[model samples]
Target: MTNLNASHASHRNFILTGIPGTPDKNPWLAFPLGFLYTLTLLGIGTILAVIKVEPSLHEPMYYFLSILALTDVSLSMSTLPSMLSIYWFNAPEIAFDACIMQMFFIHVFGIVESGVLVSMAFDRFVAIRNPLHYVSILNHDVIRKIGIAILTRAVCVVFPVPFLIKCLPFCHSNVLSHSYCLHQNMMRLACASTRVNSLYGLIVVIFTLGLDVLLTLLSYVLTLKTVLGIVSRGERLKTLSTCLSHMSAVLLFYVPFMGASMIHRFWEHLSPVVNMVMADIYLLLLPVLNSIVYSVKTKQI
Candidate 1:
C-alpha cells in the first residue's frame, strides 16, 4: 500500500522549470517590483510598529488595521522571494513540495486578508452606527474573540485547497504556465479527472472570497446610510473620513482581483504574459497600493 501511494504521488509530481537559456527575462521589471516590495514592507512595518508602540491605538479599529498590514506583508513575502529569485539568479525551477508550500501560504494570507477586511468593516459599523455601544461591544475580550473568529474563518475556508491539490493526479503536463502554481493553472496539469478539483476550487471562491466581499459591501452600505443620517456636517464628514482608508484599500485589492480572475476564467485565450502581469498586479501591486492608500489617507495609520 505504501509503494502504491508513493507511485501515485510520483505520478502527480509536476516538473517545473525555468525559462530557457535566458533564465532571467526582464531585469528592468525586477527593479520596480523590488522597490514595491520594499515599500510594502516599510509601510506595513510602520503600521504594525505604531499600533504596538502607541497605547492610544489599542482600540478595535487599530487592532484590525495592524492585522491588515501584517497580512499584506505575509502575502507579499509568500510570492516576492520566488519572483525576485527568478529575476535575479534565474532560478525558476521550484520543487514540487516548495511549490505546494507557496500555494498554501498564498491562499492562507489571501483568506486572512479577506477576513481582516471584513473585521475592519464590522469595526467601522460599530463605531459609526453604534457609538454608544462601541466600548461595551468591542472591548479587549471582544477583540480577542473577533481575532480568533477571523483566523478561524480564513483557515476553514482555505484548508481544502492544498488538500485537494495533493489528492489530484498530475501525470500529464508538469510545467505551470505562470510563475507560481496557481490553483487553476495547477488543475490544468492534472492527468486524472479534474472535475473534483475544479468544483472544490469553485466552492472556495464562492465561500471564502465571495462571502467576504458580500459582507464587506453590506457593512459599508449600512455605514453609509448611518453617516447620512447624522445632522451635523462636521460629524458626518469625520465619520466618513474614518472609513475612507479601509474603503479605498478594499477597492484596490478586490477590483483588480475580480477582473483578473474573470479574464482568466472566461477569456482563456488571453495572452499568458497578460495573465502573468495581471497576477503580479493583483498579488504584489495591490498589497503595496493598500499600504499607501491606508497610510496617506488615514494618517493615524
Candidate 2:
C-alpha cells in the first residue's frame, strides 16, 4: 500500500476495487463481465451499422437512436480498461491522472446519454403530436444541430469536474468504492473541504439527469394527451406502441441511476458491495439492456 497521505496528489496511485466482499472471485467474475461486454459492443455495433446501411431508416427518430447507441458504446469503453484489469489480472492500481481522465470521459458520455434520451423523447413528441410535418420539423439540419448542442452541453457541464477533483488534496486511502472512476467516489477520498465539489456535483446532476428526466416526462405527457384525442381505438394503441422502446430505455437508465445515487446518499450503512453492484448495473448493464430493448421493440432495427 503506497502512503498516499505523505505524497503529492499527482504522485499517488488510487486502488480500484473489483468487488468488496469477494476478491477471490474476481477472476471468475471476469467471464460474465467479458460476455456482457462483448454482447454490448456487438449489439450497439449492429445498431449503428443497420442505421447507416439502410436508406429507409434515415429519419430523425433513428438519427437520435444512433446517437444514443454511440453514447452507450463510448461510456462502456471508457470504463472497460480499468474494469478488465481489475477483474482479470488483479491489477487495481490506477495513476491519479488516469483516474481523473477516466472520470471525465465517463461523466461526459453519461450527460450526453441523458441528452440523447431527451432528444428521442422530443422526437416521439413531434412524430405523435404532428405526424404530417414531422419530416420538415426535424430535418437533417435540425438533427445535426441537436447533436452538436448535446455534445457541447455535455462538454461544458463536465469540463470543470476534472479540475475540481484535481484541486482537492487526497490524504486518505485511495481505494474507490466501485470498479470504475466516478466523480462522487473520487471526491469522497479528498482530504480537503469538498463543499464546492459536492455542491457542483449536485447541481450538475440536477441540471443534466434531473432536467432530462423532467423533459422526457413532459414530452410523454403531451404525447399521451395527443393519443387520447384520436377517435379510433386502434390508432391510439398504434401511436402509443412507438413510444414503448424509448420509455423502456429511459426507465432502464434513470431507475438504476437514481437508485445508485440514493444509495450513495442514504444507504451508506449497506455493504460497499451493494453500492458496487448498483453502479455496475447503471454503467454496464444499462447499455446492453438499451441495445436489447430497441432491437426487440423497433422493427426497423
Candidate 3:
C-alpha cells in the first residue's frame, strides 16, 4: 500500500516557477525578454533563408553556419512556449510527463548544438589547412552525413535520460526551479536514491560537452599554427579573422554553460535569489547574443 501510494505521487504534476527562485516585482522585464525572442528569431531565420538560396553561401562554412543557426533556433524554441506561458500568461503548472518530454528535447538539442559547433570548428580547420581541397573534402554529401551523425549521436546519448528520470520516484515537492525542465534540476526533486542519476549526469556532461569543447579548442590551436606559418601578415590576419564569429559564439554559449554547471555544484553556498536570476540569463541570453555576433562579424550575414 505504501509503495503504491508513493508511485502515484511520483507521477503527479510538477510546478514550474519563472526561473527557479522567488518571484520578481518587475513584471516589466517581460518586454526585454520578448525583444530577445524576436531578435533571435528574425536574425537567425533571415540567415537560414539566405543560406538556402545563395549558391555562393552553400559551401561548408555557411552550411555549418546554417546548422548553427538552426540549432540555436531549436534550443530557443524548446523552452520558448513554456517561458512565454509563464511570463506572458502567468501559467506555471506543468505535468510530469510534459516536464520529462521538455527535458528530453532541451538536453538532446543542447548536445546537438555543441556537436554542431565542434563540427564547425573542424570545418574551419579544414578550410584553413587545405584551401585547395576544402570543397572536395567537405562536399554537400559529406556535410549532410555530418549533420545526420550529430543528430544520431545526440539522440543515442540522451536517450537514456528520460528513462533514468522515470526510474526514480519523485515523491517530494514537485515544483521545479526553472521555467523549463532541466535534467539536473529535476534530479534534485526525486525523493529516491539519485546516485544513478547524479553519476550518469556527470558522465554525460564530461563525455559529451567536455569532449566537444576540448576538441573544438584543439581544432582552433591547429588552425592557428597553420595560419602563423604564412609569411604575409595580411594573410595571417585574414585567415584568423574568419574564426572571430565562431569564437564569439563558442564563448557566449560556454560561459553560461560553465556558469550553470558551477552553480549546480555550489548552489547551496549561494543565495536563492541569484540562482533564478542567473538561470534566466543563462537560458535566454545565448541565442540573442549569438545572432548579433554572427550578423556583425560575418560579412554574408
Candidate 4:
C-alpha cells in the first residue's frame, strides 16, 4: 500500500468531546444546549416570518435582515445536530469526511454572517448618508446582488478548508476539543505538518472576517459622521436610533468570536473546559441575542 493511502486508511474517524472533565455528565449537558437551540430557532424563525409576511417590509433594509436571519439559522443548524448527538446520545464518533463537512459549513456560514453584517453596515451608511438616494441606490436588485456576493465570497474563501485538511493525514489522537468541528481544533488532530493548513486558515480569517470587520467599522464611522450633519440634537438622536439594532448585532456577532479566537491564540494555558464553554458562547450567543435585539429594537418588526 502507498504511504499516503495507508495513513488515510488508518485514521478515518474522530471523537468529539462535548465538554471537558465531566464524561458522566454529558447527557445532562444536552438539556441546556437543547433549550438554547429551541429558543434560537423560534426567535430567528419569528423574525424571518414577520419579514416575509409583512408587505411593508419589502425594502432594502429588511431584505438584508432576512439574509441575516437565514445566516443565523444556518450557523445554528451547522453545529447543533452533532452537538446534541454528542451530549445526549454519547455519539461522539464521526468519520473524517463528516468532520470536515461540518467544519466547512460552520466556518463558511460564520464568514457569511460576518459579510452580511458588513453589508448591513453599508446599508445603514447609505440610508443615513444619502437618504434621498437610498431607495434608488439599494433597490431590490442591488440587495439581491449583495446577498449573493456575500454568500459567494464566503463559499469561495472557505471552499479550500476541507480539501486542505483532508489532504493532511490525521494519524494522531483523533479527539476534538468540543462537540463541534472547528477548523482550528480539527487542524490540531492531523499528524502531518499543518503549517500550510494553519497559515491558510489564518490568511482566510484575516482577509475575510478581519477585512469585513474593518470595513464595517468604517461604514459605521461614516454613518455616524453623516448623522451628525442633522442640525437638531433630537434629529441626530433619532437618526442614530435607527441603527441601534444593527449596532447590537455587530457587537454580539463579533465580540464572542473574537474572544474565542484570542483564547485559541494566546492563552493556551487555560483549561480545555474554558475553551469549550467559550466556543459554545460564541456559537450560541450571537443568533439568539441578535434575534431578540432585532425583534425588539427594530420598530417595523
- Specify the highest-TM-score model's number: 2
Candidate 1 scores a C-alpha RMSD against the true structure in Å of 3.5
lDDT of 2 by residue, 1-301 (tens): 3664356444368999888878888899899999989999999999999999999999999999999999999999999999888988889999999999999999999899999999999999999988899999999999999999999999999999999988988876788888889999998888789999999999999988999989999999999999999999999998999999999999998888998999988899999878988889999998899999999999888
Question: Which scores higher on lDDT, 1 or 2?
Answer: 2
Residue pairs with backbone atoms closer than 3 Å in model 2 (clashes): none
Query: TM-score of every model?
Result: 0.89, 0.96, 0.94, 0.95
lDDT of 1 at 22: 38
Best by lDDT: 2
Query: Clash pairs of candidate 1?
Result: none
| lDDT, model 4, position 9 | 59
Task: Indicate the residue-level lDDT of 72 in model 4.
Answer: 93
Query: What TM-score does candidate 4 get on C-alpha atoms?
Result: 0.95
Candidate 3's TM-score reads: 0.94
Please give the RMSD of candidate 3 to the true structure: 2.1
lDDT of 4 by residue, 1-301 (tens): 6986775654788888876778888899788888888999999889888888999988789989999999998999999879877988889998888888999999999999999999999999998888899889999888888888989999998998888887887776888888888999988877778899889988998999999999999998898888888899999999999999999998888888888898888998999988877888778877888899999999989
Per-residue lDDT of model 1, residues 20-56, tens digit only: 3334455555777789899999888887888899888
Q: Give the clashing residue pairs of candidate 4, or none.
A: none
Q: Score residue 60 of candidate 2 by CA lDDT.
A: 92
